[model samples]
Target chain A: MENFTPGASFLGGVLIGLSASLLLLCNGKIAGISGILGGLLRPVRDDTLWRVFFIAGLLAGGAILRLVSPQVFDIALTRSGEVFLLAGLLVGFGARLGSGCTSGHGVCGISRLSPRSLLATLIFMTAGIVTVYIVNTFFGGAL
Target chain B: MSTLVTSFLAGMLFAVGLGLSGMTQPAKVVGFLDLTGRWDPSLACVMLGAIAVHAPAYRLIRRRSAPIFAAAFAIPTRRDFDLRLVGGAALFGIGWGLGGFCPGPAITSLPSGHTAVLLFVPAMVAGMYLHTLVEGLQVRRSGIVHPETVSRSPTLPPSPALQYRHDA
Candidate 1:
């Protein structure tokens, strides 16, 4: 509860919604980060440029945040490198196989009321909940 | 040029949103996921805020015939409830809960020069390729030329009938 900033989180959420909406409105694209990055992994001809630009924007955004408010970026990753690596793999596979992540399924997809997105969001969130439980309670937060 | 600008701006906005929402912090994300622990409801607020804005926006945008930069709405149209969607999501959730970094925040944090993100992003990419390989292998074993038969290429300009690309 100590880290909970409801107002800021809500504001940030609004911004995320605005970004996704704008992407859909202007570019006719869904702002799924994994899909955007995944597509780049395969390197399609017509799609690569836009993704690169978008990714660059993301990098720049992060860099700018780092420069301006370094405190905001003070993300505490308590997990081990191995844990991060394993989680990364699962995320990559699951996002591709599931066809979206928090953005695509949780935000954009849910907004559209897509059944698949709803299901994906539910499953992932549940999985996240369960994993956190196991890691913290059973594994003693070492995983 | 417009597409590039919009895409870049969208990316920036999204990253800023993530940062502001405390999504860039693994502890915050884990806090939300840790329902049994000291649960921080910030991530839920973020989702609620995003959905509140996006759902209405989606309705308004759908009323239009075409987007300004593209010919039509690039939305996924698949209706089937298959294993890929559920299984993939379940696996992704485990990863997210374990890592506290989804694709967007992870990608956004790459330039921060953090040891965790540097290792995680590459491993995530490797995991993506690994899935593709496994999928290809599965298709080959089944002796089918048609892979992802029910789904369209997620990378192309999204068609109405295209399967959704569930990237977060």
Candidate 2:
């Protein structure tokens, strides 16, 4: 925990935003993680290849990073893998119900000045804040 | 070859960013939010870093009428903040607090061979299908289904009927 540095985080965010922006510039997509994964379920033959490659590249990046700088990748999931998985599902549910995720609404959506994105981003951030408060205070950090 | 390729590469870069920032791991996310103990600020850094990098690019995108890949720009025109927004946010919060992973990190983590992702991804997909199912049922019950189906394009302006917007 003490080892966490703002520099690395900032660099990572920059990369995320840049990647998102470039995707928008080139693919004209929102870089919404949910939408990308959702596409996998009913993939068009023409669209299937790119999505697979995109996802594969994501995994490869992590593996490569782990290989290059194991220290940088030291953070591990503290919760039982099951809990994290359930949490992931809920987030997905929420993102769909709300029509986008943080990347869509929080990043690209807001940047685009879409009113829906603004509202969605607000919900996303608030949910994150409340979740932290409840988990740390009410639950006594049980999770 | 054009937009898809560009976006695919961009998506890869985004994945790399998550990998580099330690976001792909749920523990760090949970630890940062732990507040009571570890209280990690890595998420903040991720947000800040993303904002800084996109500032310039955003300006350029704004100048364009529409993106290159699609026929027109992708923008949601609704202005009201309504029940759907509030309710969804509440649901999102509970889930995030209970589980450290958000949709982006959760999906990205899937290829990493994490067992949690195995559980989460399916649950997430099921949830999505359920929403669509419920909506389909509602439309059928009304006997006004065909017109509704015709109006369901992402590019179409968001209709309040499809989503309750508060700004109205």
lDDT leader: 1
Candidate 1, residue A69: CA error in Å? 1.2
Locate the minimum summed-lDDT window of 10 residues in model 1 chain B. Answer: B159-168
> Model 1 over residues A1-143: C-alpha lDDT tens digits?
88779999999999999999999999888999888888776564566788998888899899888887766656575778898899999999999999899999999989999898999999999999999999899887766
What is residue A83's positional error in candidate 1, in angstroms? Answer: 0.9
lDDT of 2 by residue, B3-102 (tens): 5566557766887788777676666776666665677888778877887767578778858777777555444456666666666656765666666666
Residue A106, model 1: lDDT of 97
Candidate 1: residue A100 Cα off by (Å): 0.7
i-RMS, each model, one decimal: 1.6, 3.6
What's the residue-level lDDT of A123 in candidate 1? Answer: 98
- The TM-score values for the models, in the order shown, are 0.91, 0.80
- In candidate 2 the C-alpha lDDT for residue A122 amounts to 66
